[model samples]
Target: MNSSDGGTATPAASGAPRSGPRASYPAEQSAGSRRRWFVGLSVLVVVVGVALAWLGYTKFATPDVAGEATAYEILNPSTVSVQLTVTRKDPSEPAVCVVRGRSKDGDETGRREILIPGGTQTQIGMRTEVTTSKPPVIGEVFGCTMNVPPYLTQPAT
Candidate 1:
């Protein structure tokens, strides 16, 4: 029935389609809204990635002191001598290096810290011996750092 008769007309009787929603509210999302959401998420991810890269570079990329275990010798059953070559970016800054001994089964048997005194030379080679609880097959350099403990530093004269 038409509105003039004080009765509502069914959609089937009217020209409106019975299968889908009306044009006012669509069933699927609009293209513009979806594109905007995707662009916002992409920009957030790029910003987070750049922030992480900057943090990693500043913390680890360029260390003041770096060292390498050039050679090693199994001195005896419980001892391993390691030859370390250290390079200091600022030769005037003192640094400390940690060396370790590893067993055949890849277990860390022993560790020692050697001090690199500040000097005019940028590079220094030193040989140190590490005593191990178990027989060691090789010696390796763990890392070098400028954060030296109080005991490792010499007192002012």
Candidate 2:
């Protein structure tokens, strides 16, 4: 085509060459792309959240069974004879049992290790004067696995 000034103005070809700014994709297409990206991000967040919750539940919800052993008074200090019992159930291999008693002021008055099988009950006997000004409180009575040989080996079968 020719302008009035006789300057040639080329017409855009059928496979048109763009003039000025190129046309943008339609609003619906851009919005759909954004929606898809958001949905993907949301799905990723949900998956990560569920995984973290499962981990937290497994880690924190389970109770610790390692420190379950306890001590009970077989005899008070007034008697000339005293007997104590320590029971361990389903203990790990090579377990060490420790029994500690504390005074009212939180002092370690006495401690002893009772010998017993891993999944059995053992009894310990002690005789001491009941001369403490304050009654004793059993502080800790628990068993833990130790990596040492038993002081008194069990008799051969």
Compare the candidates by TM-score and give the number of the best one.
1
Q: How far is candidate 1 from the true structure (C-alpha RMSD, Å)?
A: 6.0
Q: TM-score of each candidate?
A: 0.70, 0.38
Q: What is the C-alpha lDDT of each candidate?
A: 0.89, 0.47
lDDT of 1 by residue, 87-155 (tens): 999999899999999998999999999999999999999999999989999999999999998888867
TM-score for candidate 1, residues paired by index:
0.70
Residue-level lDDT of model 2, residues 23-123, one tens digit each, is 23232567888999999999999999999999999888733223333334524542111233432333443344455555768875666554444443333
Q: Provide the lDDT at 85 for model 1.
A: 98
- Collision pairs in model 2: none
Scanning candidate 1 in windows of ten residues, the lowest lDDT window is 16-25
Alpha carbon deviation, residue 149, candidate 1 (Å):
0.7
Clashing pairs in 1: none
| Residue 114, model 2: Cα distance from true site in angstroms | 5.4
